[model samples]
Target: MYRYLEQRLAVRIMEFLRQRYPETALPAVVIEQPPKVALGDFAIPLFPFAKPLRSAPLKIAESIRSEIGSIEGIAEFRVAPPGYLNVRIDRAWLALAQALARDHVPKEEATSGKILVEHTSINPNKAAHIGHLRNAVLGDTFVRLLRYAGREVDVQNYIDNTGVQVADVVVGFTHLVKKSRPEIDVLAREPRFDYYCWDLYARVSQWYAQDKQNLQARSETLHAIEAGNNETAAVAETIASAVLRRHLETMERLDIEYDFLPRESEILHLHFWDAAFTKLKSAGVLTYENDGKNKGCWVMRRAGTGKSEGQQAEQALVQESGGERVLEEEDQKVIVRSNGTVGYVGKDIAYHMWKFGLLGQDFGYRKFYRYPNQHECWISAIEGEKHHPHFGGVAEVYNVIDARQSEAQSTVIEALRELGHNEAADHYTHFSYEMVALTPRCAAELGYALSEEDKTRPYVEVSGRKGFGVKADDLIDQLIVSAKSEVDSRHPELGDEERRSIARQIAVGALRYFMLKYTKQSVIAFDFKDALSFEGETGPYAQYAVVRANGIFNKAALDADEFARNVANKIPAEEFSQFLNGEATDEIWELWLSSSKTSYVVNQCIATTEPAYLAKHAFQLAQLFNAFYHRHPILSEPNEKRKQFLLATVAVVRRELTRTLAVMGITVPPVM
Candidate 1:
């Protein structure tokens, strides 16, 4: 309702300006909130109009104030000094209209196409870490925001089942542990098999470092796995599939799910790279470099970097003698090596082509996993079910990768443009974010061996190759234990099962909200003390606000939803306006005002691809409601009309907070 009124007012103001100045070119209508509600609900500067109208800004402000007459939902307009048009909302009409609307759920905007979000592409070799959690949470939150705005979305997790990481893990079980296929299968059935592999993966890295001969096995294992159906391939597939299941479980604890899992093994078996390679050659996207350091390689020009003048002249002379020569190796990205092995970017190009439906091929699909909610997740296969849901061919794509992969991501986009899929390239989004590390205090708490140098730094980086990182599940378990200790103390009378459930909710909320409260570009140093606190700017703070609001109704023996339903008919317009406009009721008015911006903040979040804005808005709303709760005691008040107004304010805040937390993937339990 707030968004509708704002847009409607902007359109009216534009019309008024056009009629008042027939010969002048008009500017876009810009509306911004005033610094304080006491000043005005919205402010529009007339400075831009001054030049166009050939008049002073103060004069234009007065003229717009006089000409823009009688806009709905606007009580009055004022011309402030220094050329500003401050508009006050019609409190009586707006309060009643918003109360009658109940929750102000906006209608979906007209979106034209489906959006594909691929995230949490964890290597299927070991357990997930805190860094991967940041990626999954960001992607999942964005998906929820898109769905709330009524977009068609498909969530995908690309599995690198045939990559070198998985190959090394296979070498571990087969060569180091001397485990047979049946023995490995038994291990997979055991609990925390991914954690076992995580340790073995580090051991494998160490073994290779000890002897140069062990590295040969890694290369051979990678080749066999890529070839498929050999013993090496079978072992790699089992480890990758089991580890993939573990990753899904870790993500599900935070309420994140996917629609599909596209594996690189399927890309190899189905010959997707072969199809993409043909088109690349035909379009000259990849050229053979027969000389220089990249000799006998197929390479694509790097984005935004050009050859030096001397190198270009040398390349021209060399090309006359030999085809495609004299290019700097660093200036080109190798797509196919001299040994006829396709690079990671080569396969990624094909995968993205399939995403935009530009490839003339499709992956065979089968239902591989199902969630508790009964939503089936599909996986790529060589042969599969005939009646399966279609997986790819989306109009837009967002790949949630870390900032370290910027070069590879840019190469994929360049390939798309080179192949004439300009629109797909334009629509493609590399949802890049920085990595997550552990704070010095957190690292010490994890029992990690931090040197004195590390202790002096703000954070300690973790490496999977060295088995130094905290596993995602381990961190989640520790958080639950911590939360359970707090919950047991606060609610000792509650049953064991109920307390455990509440602790899980609080733990998950703390983890997800902590990951979301910062911008994508900000690197978070995870710490428990900051995330678990219930007092300020934490998930528990917001959840506690909702619980307190619920307690108000529980004590008063009133139904919040019922009171909200009857509020429009019960409170007269004059009375509603009087309570809001009264100077004495400033605190309650602030709460009401904060609750109205949920939709506005959501729109801002989607436009900016920044979930931190919405997180901050939720925190601010909780702060305002807490202030209101202390200032006004609704049940103890003598004036019934004023009590009803305060009750309605609580109702709206509860609804908005509930909705905001839901979108953030944070759940509010029955009793927080």
Candidate 2:
């Protein structure tokens, strides 16, 4: 409703300006909310009109205020000194209209193309760590926000099943432990197989360091996995499939799910790279070098390059700079190596082209896993079901990879543009974020020894190869334990199952909010203490506000819907308007204004591609509700109309906060 009003007001302001200043060119009128409710419900600066109107902003504002007179739902307009039109809303009218709204409020639909969001592309080798959670949580929250805004979305999780990471784990089981394929399969069936691989992966890393010749086994394992049709390949597939299942389970605990899991193995077996290779060669995007360091390899001209120092020096000798100075082999990135094996980047380019449905190919689909909700998640296969949900051909793609892959991401975009798919390149988003590290205190709490230098620093980086990071499941379990202690201390009379359920809700809320509270570019130094706190700007704090509001309705023996239905016909117009417009009621009015701006905040979040704004808005809404709860005692108030109005305020806040939390992927417990 607030979103609708903002647009309506803008139209009136623009119409009035065009009529009043016929000869002058006008800019788009910008509507802004004032910092305080006392100032205004909305503010528009007159400075944009100053020079065009040939008048001071103050004079222009006053003139416009006089001309745009008596708009409905507007109480009054005041001209501030330096050129601002502050418009106060008709508080009584807005309050009554919103209160009497039906059970369901329709959202303004968003007009956008099908959006493909690829995130949580964890390697299928070991347990997911704290860093992977940041990526998954951020991507999942954004997906929720997009769906809430009425966009068609497809969620994908890319699995690097045939990558070097998986090969290393295979090396450990095959060469180091000297285990046969059947033995490795037995080990994989044991509980926490991913955890076992985590330790084994570290041992393999150390074994390679001990002697370079030990690395030969890794090369053999990788080649077998890539080539297929061998025991080494069979072992790799068994281990990768098991580890991928563990990764999915870890993410499901946080309520994250995906529509597709695209595997590199299928990408190789289904000839996706071959199709992409033909396109690249036909378009002259890949060059075959015959006599240089890259002899016999096919490479692409790397994006974001400048002349080398030696080339720049030679170019100065000629009047016209020599064209590219006989391009160095080092200047190109190898798409296919001298050994005829495709590189990782080459496979990624093919994957992205498939994402945009430009490769003229598609994967054979197979149902891979099922969520607790019984929704089937599909995986790519060479031979599979005859009928399934179509996976690709998206109009917009967001790859939620980390910032370190900026160069590789750019290369893929450049590949798209070089293929004459300019629109696809333009629509592609690299959605990059920085890494997550643990605070020094957190590292110590997890029993990781820290050097003095580490203690002095703000955060300690984790190394998966060294087996020195917190597993995603481990972190979640620890959070549940911490939250459970709090829940049990506070509600000992509750049954064990109920208490555990509430604790799990609080734990997930804390973890997801902690991941989202920071901007994407900001490096997160996660700390358990900060995340689980109920008194600060954490998930629990926002959720507590909703719980408090629910308690009020329960104690009064009346729900918000019942009170809203009864209020309109019982209270006199004068009495309701006085309660809303009186000077003493300004703080209460602020809560109403904040609750109504949910749509406004959603628009801002989508425009900026930032979820942090939504997080901050939710925290502010919660804060406002807490203040209102303390300042105005609804149940204890004697006046019937005043009590009803206060309860209505609680109802609005509760609804908005619940919606906000849902978008953030945070669940509120019934008795938190």
Which prediction has the highest TM-score against the true structure? 1
Error of 1 at 625 (Å): 0.9
* Model 1 ranges with Cα > 4 A deviation: 102-108, 306-328, 450-455
Q: What TM-scores do the predictions have?
A: 0.94, 0.93
Measured on C-alpha atoms, candidate 2 has an lDDT of 0.87
Q: What is the clash tally of candidate 1?
A: 0
> Between which residue pairs do clashes occur in model 1?
none
lDDT of 2 at 271: 90
RMSD to true structure for each model, in Å = 2.9, 2.9
lDDT of 2 by residue, 422-492 (tens): 99999999889999988999899889899999999999888889888889988899889888999999899
lDDT by residue (tens digit), candidate 1, 317-394 = 877877553345557899999888999999999999999998889988999889999999999989988989887889
Least accurate 10 contiguous residues by lDDT in model 2:
101-110
Question: Model 2 reaches what TM-score against the true structure?
Answer: 0.93
